[model samples]
Target chain A: MGRRKVTHQLISDNATRRVTFRKRKDGLLKKIYELTVLCGLPACAIIYSEYKDGPELWPNLNEVRSILNRLSELPVEKQTKYMMDQKDLMNKMIQDAEKKLEKEKMHTRAMKLGLMAGSNDLITDTDCSEELARAADVVDKKLKAIRERIKAVEAGAPIIKRD
Target chain B: MQSSNVTDCTMRKRGTKRKIEIEKRMTKQQRSVACSKRRPTLFSKAADLCLLSGANIAVFVTSPDENSDVVYSFSGYSHASEIVDCYLNNKSPPKTTINPESAKFWWEEPDLYRDCDDLSELRIIEDRLMRTKKHLMDYLEKKEKSHSVSKSDQNPNNDSGSSSSSSQIASDFGQNPSTLSPSSLKIVSFDQNSYSSLEPSSQVTTCFDQNPVFSVGSESSSDQSRYLVNEDSGFVDGLLCETEEENNGMRLPQETQTQPMFTEEDQSFWENLDVDDVFGLFKDDNNLEVPLQDHSSTNEDDELLIDISEYLSEEAMECPCFS
Candidate 1:
């Protein structure tokens, strides 16, 4: 029988959750063991549950201690060189997204200039050109209003401002 | 074809299998069996991930049995304790010395050092090219000045005196005027100070007199004929060979003797030189604003010469990174 796709969510029933946890725990331990063997790098995981009296150790207690000792021996700078937590990962992702947005904005500006110069080949997306045209119309309207205000001031007339 | 047929058979078998809900409540026996079977498959997946990405991972899981006190732990090649410790340490705030705002993962940092090294190497090559160009310009200027002086000296009364005198000298040397190519002529004793102090016409005459083989009245007509006979083979080669033989064991340095003297390659180097290419090297430098198309004014040429000299004398000598 083919296994049905399971939605990613917490199991609500206690019995079902326990069963699922047991299956997943075994699977996770096996995966970690395989990863250690294949990558030749030290990795360790600790899982806490209300059902367990003590956490299980992979390989054994002695190997885990030795690996921790090796990690501790490294200088703090070297240890932290590649280290990142949830917050750091999130911050990095946000920074990357912002940089991408800035690049896209610059590209859009260049495309708008190309459009104004009457080049159609620069139009990669119809929506982008439409948005740019709307923005251009808004800017043109603002410019006309500013020009009218300047002429009113030159003619020594009191101008009422409207938005 | 056989592999395709096997794949088709597997696909047919897969299609025939009934879908079972993985999330449905399972009996205790069924759950135990599923856990046992899935363990190896999960391990294989982890092994594949480790092999592909070189990631260090460790996972620990508690026993699901209410009576069981066992907590299982799994680690990659390294000890699980190390990864756990690293993870714990990473969970804490980083040191104050390290700016949190600028902190990036090792992979995120750009390889600026390699780019810097490339830029430095390019600067070295550009500097060398500029020095070579300056030397070539100085040589051509000296040659032009000497040629004009020689012409004026030869023809004080007539405009065609240089042509006539050259022909006379060529006849005296028993060679065609065209055969005495300017590129073949090597300056033996000329220096900047000597060139400035001595008259160009006198210096030109003295060059021939300085050589024993070419001393007009000193050598017999027959001896001159013998030297001229060898000259028919190659003017520069004959002169060098005769000089070496006459010097009686005096030999020039290997580099001096083997060094190429104004070959076609060198001629092409000058011909193919582009001012734009030289300027392009400094295009990214904000402090330097080289006028791309302006080379017509003598003042600009002088300024460029000064800039090249400054680069060669000051910057090149004191560039600590390259040194």
Candidate 2:
């Protein structure tokens, strides 16, 4: 009857709790459907009434479930917005990673060049094979770094690239 | 008539009061209170959805009902154990953990079963991991041995020690290389449940292997044909062609660029699709079949009504999926 703060411990009035639940539950399911439509994600909601024997659906729950289930087919309305934002982040990460790898490779390359340039005939740093090995090391380090990042997903094995 | 209207008013007044009483039922103060009250009902709806859609759902309801009862509902004719299996495995997804697939492994190796020896015990886990590490080390040793023993001419430079490195690298290089590459390079076959990759080195950097790797098949055009249809080189070649085309107005040869034939993915999509699932793109067949009538037949020629059916059909073909 009056706008008072509701404690949620238990509705002190018996008849009021039932009424409030019915209205709020319907609204809850509606909110869920709206979210699924707008968000395009798989969401299965369960509702159990305090008085009722079991949980019950609002409506159109099946259509919503199926839509969410076929996730790949579902138009990723989030894709465009998320792509723009995530692209910047992911590209930044990639560039950062690439730069880090480049620094590592340059450092390795410089070390190998120093080794070759400074060698007085200890090991055969004197051949094309050593040059190939140096290039191979840089590629190997870069690829391993990338592989570790990509392996975050389940997909396995990477295609090799020759410089 | 006045008396009847009074009686009607009483009835209407009573009905209105009853409706208002119903509205006073559920709490709507804070968002969390609303969520807590309505969560169970939401789960119930989700269970119904799973049943109606014939989708396997294994729900791990983080919260309980108003009475503090945890309820688990799977699809019809499924065991509680299976549903629990799906729930505990937690592979459903990060978002949809509320719904999980049935425990029916689509395809898997047989004879796998849980041991009664303290399945949840930390000691067992530690022991299993230790055994795994030991096996891995042994495997690496064997691989290094094999790699060193490969064709005498292949790695004539490196001491035979690299043979074992090659063998160890073979599995890691082939298996999970992602700690590094986002490019999902896979060799998939319909018969195989998943890619049964060869053992790779633990490091995952064998892709830069000095020597090229090739797969052989038994008496099949899949491999060793006079014209090698190298799936790996094809990707590089495609990239190169794309780059060349971008720089110099040229395209990959039409023969090499034949679009992939229909695949199981397309077939699976069709299988999942219902007969009536039109996606609502087609307007009507009557419009398609109806020929454009000549309005100039009975009158002098003014503006010619071009038959646009051909254009419609042509546009329809370009619509890849519907066609």
Candidate 3:
């Protein structure tokens, strides 16, 4: 059976959270092992939890110290070459999303102008086609309202407002 | 009949959907089993990342046992100390080590063909090969055009129109040998008082109205009475002999002689050339591997090579009849 989509939130129950943590912690350690072995690079992780007596160290304390020492020996510029903190990662993600949004907005504006000019050429894109369908629905509603108004005037009865 | 009934029951169980309560707490034994089973898969993925991107990584995880203080640690290197120390000293949060512009995550890199499936990997390789071939072809064509221009320039008797056209072609390639223009060719008298500023080894001075051509003597002579011609094979021979004599009678360097005078074989080679031949040349020369290893470094090297090639082509333009 296929798994359901996981909710991105912490488990409220203490027992369940502890269980999840153990499982995830093991998975994280395994990943670190694979990375170090496959890439032949220095890497170390330290994890702390209430369940454990002390913070867990991958590959032992000696290896972690060696990796850290090597990294510390490098110049500050070299050390930071590919480094990004949580804030930096978030900023980068935000910037990329904003750029994409701006591009999408421009595309939508162009599509709207094309529709207004009564040209179907811009309908080539799926997004443009969807937008066209929406515009057509609005136009249909407006036409129906106008038709109702005209009928009311011809019948000389009270005209109900429709939007 | 009993065996058939048992088989039917098994089939019914297999066909039933089992909804997992993802948020519910699992039993202690189930949790342990899950951790054990998932750990190997996680490690395998990390290994793949390390192998593909050459990135250093370290991970530490605390054990779930309530009384245990043991923290599991894994490192990409022999010891995780190097990475840990770097992190501690730098006080920077961990981020991806690969170029961010190329890929936010190492796994996202398209160039890591190892991660791609067979068809896509093949397509990437083919695309790279095609681009390399195109670049090689362009370089060869440029070299040929420059060679032809240099050849035309060697004939001093050629009309101004031909010289100008050759110059135009040379200019198109951004390599105009301005000093060696045919229109600027003139034989000026070698006056010791005026030419005394020239190098002591430059015994023969050939001057045009604009540019001066200085020729070193065959021997240590103070004589400035030798007349330098501005026309034909004689001038070329004098220049070559003067240059060769300076190098202890060694022929011009192989690099300067790269653009050989057009021959029937060369013409045929150009005619028969195709993508396969270019690809073969790349393979034979081992030029294809450099770009694959480090694209940025290779790009810088390629630019430098282009500059050197242009300089050499200009030198060739100045003395086309070296052979």
Model-by-model DockQ, in order: 0.04, 0.01, 0.04
All candidates: CA RMSD (Å): 32.7, 38.6, 29.9
Q: What DockQ number belongs to candidate 2?
A: 0.01
DockQ, computed on Cα atoms, for candidate 1? 0.04
Measured on C-alpha atoms, candidate 3 has an lDDT of: 0.49
Docking class for candidate 2:
incorrect
| Comparison by lDDT, 1 against 2, better one | 1
State the lDDT of candidate 2 residue by residue for B111-226, as single tens digits: 23334366566476567767878988999999988887785558574544443433333344444322312232322211111113322211111122243333333223233212
Residue A107 miss distance in model 2 (angstroms): 45
Q: Which model scores highest in lDDT? A: 3
Residues B118-232 of candidate 3 have per-residue lDDT tens digits of 9977787778767878988999999999998998889755465554554543353345545444342323334433455443233232434344443333322323232323333
Clashes of each: 8, 56, 36
- Quote the lDDT for A93 in model 3: 55
Instruction: Show pairs that collide, candidate 1.
Output: A36-B76, A36-B77, A41-B78, A42-B78, A44-B80, A53-B69, A56-B71, A56-B72
For residues B2-75, write the lDDT of model 1, one tens digit per residue: 99997787778865875443352346555445544544454444433322222344553333344433333344
Better of 2 and 3 by TM-score: 3
TM-score against native, each model: 0.24, 0.16, 0.25
- Pairwise DockQ winner, candidates 1 and 2: 1
For model 2, the stretches where C-alpha displacement exceeds 4 angstroms are A64-163, B1-323
